[model samples]
Target: MYHEQHGAPAVAPLAGFTVGVTAARRADELGALLQRRGAAVLHAPALRIVPLADDGELLAATKELIDNPPDVVVATTAIGFRGWVEAADGWGFGEELLACLRGVELLARGPKVKGAIRAAGLTEEWSPTSESMAEVLDRLLDEGVADRRVALQLHGEPLPGFVEALRAGGAEVVVVPVYRWMPPEDLAPLDRLLDATVGRSLDAVTFTSAPAAASLFSRAEDRGMLPQLLDALAHDVLPACVGPVTALPLQAVGLDTVQP
Candidate 1:
């Protein structure tokens, strides 16, 4: 196993290093890969999946829509839509849910999501050039969303900010968060990983998503260990991000990310 130096101009694998894995439910998937590659794995799930509120609001929204479906739906994630479909089923509105969007304005966010939509037997009415949310927002804005009834099937945490933005543009947004991304309610297990990183005990850390990186640093910051962890990552430890989004926040901390 070779050691990697910071800004070394390579995205090589660290075979003999210990890394903090920050995937949510798929931590094991990543952990298994790291183990197979000969890296000591620190299983730290920076995100947890939470179902949306079971409030009757969604049911009422479904009933009203079934009786009188709307003009468009902004299905940001296909995974979220499946959950929405299942949730609506228990409420006995799955057919209503599908029928409502049979031939209305439909916008897909990303290929991953679009794949899910297609597998669910739905075709795209409109697809964006990019997978970013802001881009999707721009598309909707350009087309004029004022007084438009748009349903948001969000998978992440509260985007009240997004809601406000849509409202500002005159879109009547009704949201159903199929899932949420949250830190481990208990950080006890991560304490060891944090200690190893802060004490310079780890050789590297791998981040799978932007939120994973953000959550780790934010928690370290809140616990007064940000300096140590940041130092370890930038000067002594290697940081690998799965994609561009995960790499963005790494730059703010003065460390560039290596994607593998």
Candidate 2:
């Protein structure tokens, strides 16, 4: 199909499609990619990334780590790891933290985190190629975590069964809570997107993270439109996810999703 709009051709693969984006980080880049394919982009950030309070638990954790460095450090996400280091820098313990980390066995969840570790003048002893935390846990267990001090860097939410498993192995697990996800301060755009989804005005919705998916569901329930939203998502609108982890929230509710 071809349409002439202001002397331009709308013959792209996604022409005539309107896609909804719910990612807060890199939303502009994702939106531009969809638009380049001729799809009308509806940008609605479902959640916002908020760093934890400066003088709160993060500072306490940093001080404790400096006083008692862990035997092993697991860096999960690149951004979260960097944020932790930068936050420590703000507290005037950046060099001390770096020196402490240099003495521990560092494990990066994936390449991005490995880069973050290396960028901080540290090297990772190991990293999983599949980028699965399960693999990292397995390595830790197989190598023996008993009687070891392990520090885990959290991205947003706690990893289910991760800390529990470490504790079960008799390892002292210290969770480094970094950034967290909160509902966007401006809900107008999200409200509009919700309305469009229920009205069948959106052809597809893209999810980059599980929290965004869950936040959308929570907002729909708050408005008492859960059934309507679920019906539209189940029948009319296509749900596109970036990866399997991001698809978990949708899958848990029996919603089919495409990863592309």
Best by TM-score: 2
- Global CA lDDT of candidate 2, please? 0.91
lDDT per residue, candidate 2, 1-260, as tens digits? 57799999668899899999999989999999988888999999999887655437788888899999999999998988999999998888999999999999999999999999999999999999978889999999999999999999987667768899999999999998887788999999999999999999999999998889999999999999889998999999999999876887898899999995
Residue 18 in model 1: lDDT: 83
The C-alpha stretches of model 1 lying farther than 4 A from their native spots are 1-13, 51-70, 158-164, 209-211, 230-239, 244-260
TM-score to true structure, per model: 0.76, 0.88
Positional deviation of 15 in candidate 2, in angstroms? 0.7
Worst 10 residues of 2 by lDDT: 49-58
* Model 1 superposed RMSD (Cα): 5.5
- Model 2, 96: alpha-carbon shift in Å? 1.3
Scored by lDDT, the top model is 2
